[model samples]
Target: MHNYFILLISLFLLSVSCNSDYTPKPRGYFRIDLPEREYKQTPEKLPYAFEYPVYSVLVNYRQTQPELYWINLVFPKFNATLHLSYKTIDNNLEEYLNDSRNFVYKHTVKADAISETPYLNAEKKVYGILYDIKGDAASNTQFFLTDSTHNFIRGALYFEVYPNKDSLAPVLDFINKDLVHLIETFEWN
Candidate 1:
């Protein structure tokens, strides 16, 4: 009787221990689904324009200066956003380029967990600064595109999130392609 009771108690303890430790795994991030390439030109009313993903919607933001502006290209289906903004320098073109560069300079020194791709190979009529920034998820992909030669048009992309760098990596990587699309297809004409 004693032996049988001991055996039953042992089995019960083992089962309880195993059950306590078992936990279902939490889900990781969902896969990023990117669309195929497509382009549409902007109207002349735009300060400077380029082709972007047709699925993306443009929302204009308040201008910081008379010639400066901000806009957002939101992908509602993807729950992602691309914030594009512009600033026209009063001085020569070089000044605008330099101003853009300096913004990154201050950012680099002060930022925490920042990852930058400082220079991008922007095509003619479009070139400036590019930074692959990640400090806050709320602050995703902060980069600048320029009409490199004339400084007539300079735009920046800021992703909206709290800087969950790990969770946001896929979207950031995916958007870079479209950003490249904007730069290459850029036309000052």
Candidate 2:
């Protein structure tokens, strides 16, 4: 009787386990504490100037073959950087525009969609295109500013970690406002 009872209990446990489905939970990222928005102007000698977040550090261009007037805004807390490059038009406005488009499109393979917003300030002679890259691309924002004559500036924001739009949405949205503010305050030196 004892042996029969043990066998019956074991069979009942196996049957119950087989009837239930096991689904794994999704992965999660650590919580981020973002700082309040504050800004400061770039140095006077730079070809162009804009207000950047006070929380970020303005670092000299450190990438390969860094050029004059190229700089990076590093967000240490977020592990991201906004790369800014300057180019003299010299009748190459079309080429610069094409390059900026190409850079934005490169992420299309991973991007769900890409949107472009034109920015024009006749008084300041600052005209540009702002790209909002969606999906899991490496960059969430890219832009190019040109006077259509002499100055052309291109910028892109990149994170150190793998692209995960869902996880980075908050940070991206926060920085987007800053980007827009920068464009609004941009001035040629």
Candidate 3:
């Protein structure tokens, strides 16, 4: 009887220990769906002419700083936003870039990852910065597109959801394609 009791106690302890040793389930990721790429052209309303995604709309008009203007497109599904900048310049391209960087700096937030890279041509002096902001209440990517002078344009894409680069990757990819299209289509007067 003593031996049987000891055996039962050992079995109970083993079962309890086994139950405590649980393996947590893996984390599930979000599955986001994106839209097809369709573009609509903007009329010759300014110095330059271009086209943007049909799904996106232009916003933010300031008469005071006409030279420094922007168009914002909000993506409610992906919980993201894209800000396209249009700056009428009267200086060197490098100067424009410096000023553009300063402008983007204002929209930047703490707990974010910022990446800057010059794109396309150097002598033509086209440059851009890709902002991947994480943990920000207002997360977005600001694309700097400029003609070096007379024009310092930027396109910013952001999301209201928690900024997870992985989750946002698909949306970013699509928006980037649109952005690239916009840049490719950009022509100076």
- Which residues of candidate 1, in runs, are more than 4 Å off? 1-27, 31-33, 61-70, 92-95, 102-125, 135-137, 147-152
Give the whole-model CA lDDT for all candidates, comma-separated.
0.62, 0.92, 0.65
TM-score of each: 0.66, 0.87, 0.69
Candidate 3's displacement at residue 187, Å, is: 1.8
Question: In model 3, where do residues sit more than 4 Å from their true spots?
Answer: 2-10, 13-17, 60-69, 92-95, 103-114, 121-140
Candidate number that wins on lDDT, 2 or 3? 2
State the lDDT at 159 in candidate 2.
Answer: 95
- Per-residue lDDT of 1-189 in model 1, one digit per residue for the tens? 999999999999998887656679976987777777676776667767788888788776555434335667787766677666565545576776676566555655435555555444445545544565555434445556555444454445554445566676776677778877776666554
Best by lDDT: 2
Q: What is the lDDT of candidate 2?
A: 0.92
For model 3, what is the C-alpha lDDT against the true structure?
0.65
In model 3, what lDDT does residue 11 have?
Answer: 99
